[model samples]
Structure formats: structure tokens, C-alpha cells
Target: MEFDELQDLARGVRQKYAAREHENYGRTWSREEIMLGFLGDVGDLAKLVQGKEGVRPREDLDEAFAHELADCLWSVMTLADSYGVDLEEAFVSTMTELNGVLDET
Candidate 1:
């Protein structure tokens, strides 16, 4: 999706959460909500990987994990938007700089 569309989606999701803030688990998320969501999703990701030995070896993703990952991405995009950063450009520049550093090393 385009940046504009992603921004719209972020707005919609934020609005949805706002509408049910006090009802659903007593959540009244603000802009910091995005950061908290991102951190929570990251923790979930770590949890999923932490017990690889005990967990069954499977390629299929657990539904909740997928949802958490999507949530993480959405929050990240929102954060990027808040900072006026175009992720596409930053991503490219970061990779390019890494490559240059690698070549130098």
C-alpha cells in the first residue's frame, strides 16, 4: 500500500481502538499506544523464538503471532509517519550505508 493509504489505515485502527478504549480490557491508548504495541509485539516475537527446542518444528505460523506481527508493522509505520520519515527511503539508505561500511571493512 502507498504511504498515504498506510497513514489512513493507521488512523482507522487508532480510531477503532479509541472507540472501544474503556470497554475492551480498559485500554485508552494514545500516541504512545503505538510504541507500546510495537514493544509488545516484539516481546511476543521473542517468546515465539525463545523455546524453539520444545516447540514443534513447523513452517506454519500461529494465527496470533501473525496478527501480532502485523500489529507491529502497523505501529512501526505510524511511528515513522509521526517522525516524517519515509521508510522506503530510509530503508534503502540504511542498506546502502551498511553495504558501504562492509566494503570498507
Candidate 2:
């Protein structure tokens, strides 16, 4: 699916979590809280990457690696949505700039 579609799906997932938070914690997570969660996911993803590279041992291996990466992506999409960022546009623009810099080298 497109990035926008994926972001919409992430929003739906966030809504479900929000409802649960309201029931369990009496409040949904703030944007900063969500960003912290994203940071946790990033840490998990880094470990998975290390395992995949043979720098660390991991029994779960393949499935955990892919899952953690997806989790990180979901967090990124949700965070971008929260900030009103057009991630697709931002990604393309950033990559274009990077490519330009690489070509200049």
C-alpha cells in the first residue's frame, strides 16, 4: 500500500490503543510519550539488526527481526501523522538531497 494508506492504518491502530489507554490509564499517550515508545522500538530494532549481522545471538532471529522493523515503521508513520508531516514528500525530498550530495562527491 501507499505511504498515506499505511499512515491511515497506523492512525486506526492508534485509535484502538487510545481507547484502551482511556480504559486502563485514564488517558491516551501524549505525542511525546508516543515518541518515547518509538525510541524503545528503535532500540529493539537495533538489537534485531545486530542479531541479523551475527554480532549478537538471537533465537527468534528472522521473525523477530522483521516484526521489530515493522514496529519501528509503524511508530515512525504514526509520529509523522501526529506532527502533520507529509512523510512521503519528506522522504523523497530528503533522498533527493542526499543523492545530490553523493553525486557531488
Candidate 3:
């Protein structure tokens, strides 16, 4: 799927999670909470990467890695939405800047 399509899907899932969070905890997660969750997901992805690289012992590394990546993506999209940031543009701009830096070396 394209970037926009993926972002839309992420938003839909985030909305459902918001509803679930409200029903269970009386409120949806705050941005800081979302960032914390993203950190946790990043930790999980790190372990999965280690496993994939034969440095850690984890079962189902491939599937878990994919899920963790999706989880991270969801958190990023949700955070960007919360802050009214244009994530796609930011990503492209950041990448372009990084590439320029690399080319100057």
C-alpha cells in the first residue's frame, strides 16, 4: 500500500484503540503514553533484530519483527496526527537532507 493508505489504516486502528482505551481506562492514551508504547515496541523490535542476526534467542522472530514494526509505524502515525504534523512530507524532507549530507562526504 501507498504511504497515505497505510497512514489512513493506522488512523483507523488508532481510533478503535482510543475507543477501547476510553471504555477500559476512562480515557485514551496521552501523547507521552503513546511515545512510551512506541519505545516498548522499539525494544521488542531490537530484540527481534538480534534474533534475526543470530545474536539473541527469540522464537518466531520473523513474524514478531513484522508486527513490532507495524506497531512502531502505528505509534508514529498517531503521534504525527496528534501534533498536526505532515509526516510524509517530513519523512521525505528528512531523507533528502540526510542524503545530501551523505553526498557531501
Candidate 4:
């Protein structure tokens, strides 16, 4: 799917989570709190990468690795949405800049 479609899906998932949080905890997560959650997911993703590379011994490695990657992607998309970032534009611009710098080196 396109990035915009993925972003929409991420928003829907965020809404579901927000509703669940409100129901259970009486409040939804703040943007900063969501960013912290994203960081936690990043940590999990790192460990999964290690496991996938055989650098770590984790049970249920393959499935857990894939799930962690998806979690990280969701967190990124959600964060970008929360911040009103145009990820596609940002990604392309950033890559272009990086490639320009690399070419000069």
C-alpha cells in the first residue's frame, strides 16, 4: 500500500488504542508518551534484529522479529502523523541530501 494509505491505517489503529486506553486508564497517551512508547518498541526491534542475526538467542525468534518490526513501523507512522510530518517528502529529501553528501565524499 502507499504511504498515505499506511498512514490512514496507522491512524485507525491509534484511535482504537486511544479508546482502549481511555476505557482502561481513563486517558489516552500524550504525544510525548507515545514517542516514549516508540522508543521502547525500538529497543525491542533492536533485540529482534540481534536475534535474527544470531547475535542473540531468543525463543520464537522469527515471528517475534517480524512483529517487532511492524510495531516499530506503526510507532514511526503514528509519530509522524501526530507531528504532521510528510514522511514521503521528508524521506525523499533526506535521502537526496545524504546521497549528495556521499557523492562529494
Candidate 5:
């Protein structure tokens, strides 16, 4: 999907969970939880690397990578929701600058 489509999709997903947050009237995930999720996904990526060296099929490796990435993205999305950050805007702005730097290099 396009960037706008993806952003809309994320908004819908967040809305679903945000409603639950409202139902319970409890806080969303904390910063620590988001950070832990990030670190855990990184560890999972490393494990996939090790597993890749084993006799596992390529499909297994791809599946593992996809799931870990999705988990990491969930944490990021949840974090953005809690903090009121616009994830798509941040991504575009940061990547624009990063791309400039890469071009300079």
C-alpha cells in the first residue's frame, strides 16, 4: 500500500485499541514496555541469524524475520500512540534528512 494508505490503516488499528483503553479507562503501554519490546525484537533477529546457519529452510527464516519485524513495528506504533507522535511524518522527515546525508556521502 501507499504511505497514506498505510497511515490510515495504522490509525484504524490504533482506534480499535484506543477504544479498549477507553473501555477500561486505563493507561496505554509505558515507555519501558515499548523499549523492552524493541530490545526483545532485536534479540529475536539475532536468533534468526543463528537459525539461518542451521539447516532450516529459507521460508522459515523469512517467516521469522517478518514476525519479529511486525512485533517491533507494533511496539513502535503503540509508543507513538501513547506519546502522540505522528509516525508517518517522523519517518518521512527523518528519511528525507538521512537520504540527503547519504547523497552527500
Candidate 6:
């Protein structure tokens, strides 16, 4: 899928979570709360990475790692949407700048 399509799918999932949060907690998560949740996802991904390296043993580590990475991507896409940033553009620009810097060296 294209980036826009993926981002739309992410937004759909994020809306579902907002509805669940409202039902459970009387309000959806704030931006800060979302960031905190993203941090938790990152921590999980880190542990999964450790498992992949055999530093932390885990059953089904590959599956867990893929899931965690997806979660992190969802968080990043959601955060970018919330902040009104065009992630695709930013990513391309950043990569171009990095390549330019590398070429200069």
C-alpha cells in the first residue's frame, strides 16, 4: 500500500482506540498520553530486539518483534497526523540531506 493509504488505515485504528478510551476512561487520550503510550511501545520493541539478539529469551520472538515494530509505526504516523506534519515529505527530505552530507565527507 502507498504511504497515504497506510496512514489512513492507521487513523482508522486510532479512531477505534479513541472510542474505546472514551468508553473506558470517559475521555480519549491526550497528545501527551499518546506519546507516553508510544514510549511504552518503544520499550516493548527494545525488549523484543534483545530477545532477537538472545540477550532476552522469548518464545515467538520474530512474531512479537514484527508486531511491536508495527505498533511503533502506528504511533509515529498518528503523532505526525496529530501535529499536522507531512511525514512522507519530511522523511524524503531528511534522507536526501543525509545522503548529501555523506557525499560531502
Best by lDDT: 6
Candidate 6's residue-wise lDDT over 1-105, tens digit each? 999999999999999999999999999999999999999999999998899998998788999999999999999999999999999999999999999999999
List, residue by residue over 10-101, the lDDT tens digit for candidate 5: 66876786677668867754478657867988888778777777744466687887788777777677677568888888999999999999
Counting only residues 3 or more apart in sequence or on different chains, how many pairs clash (N, Cα, C under 3 Å) in candidate 6?
0
Q: CA shift at 71, candidate 5, in angstroms?
A: 0.8
Top candidate when judged by TM-score against the true structure: 6
Which segments of candidate 6 are over 4 A away from where they belong?
none
TM-score of 4: 0.91
lDDT of 1 by residue, 15-35 (tens): 787779868868676668768
Clashes in model 5: which pairs? none
How many pairs of residues in model 3 come into backbone collision? 0
The candidate 3 region of ten consecutive residues with least summed lDDT is: 56-65
Model 5, which residues run further than 4 Å from truth? 2-29, 53-59
Model 5 has a clash total of 0
What is the TM-score of candidate 1? 0.65
Query: TM-score per candidate, in order?
Result: 0.65, 0.92, 0.92, 0.91, 0.63, 0.97
**Candidate 3's error at 4, in angstroms?**
1.3
Residue 83, model 1: lDDT of 75
lDDT of 5 at 101: 100
State, as a TM-score between 0 and 1, how close model 2 is to the true structure. Answer: 0.92
Model 4, range 41-104, lDDT digits (tens) per residue? 9898888888888899778998898888899889888888889998889999999999999999
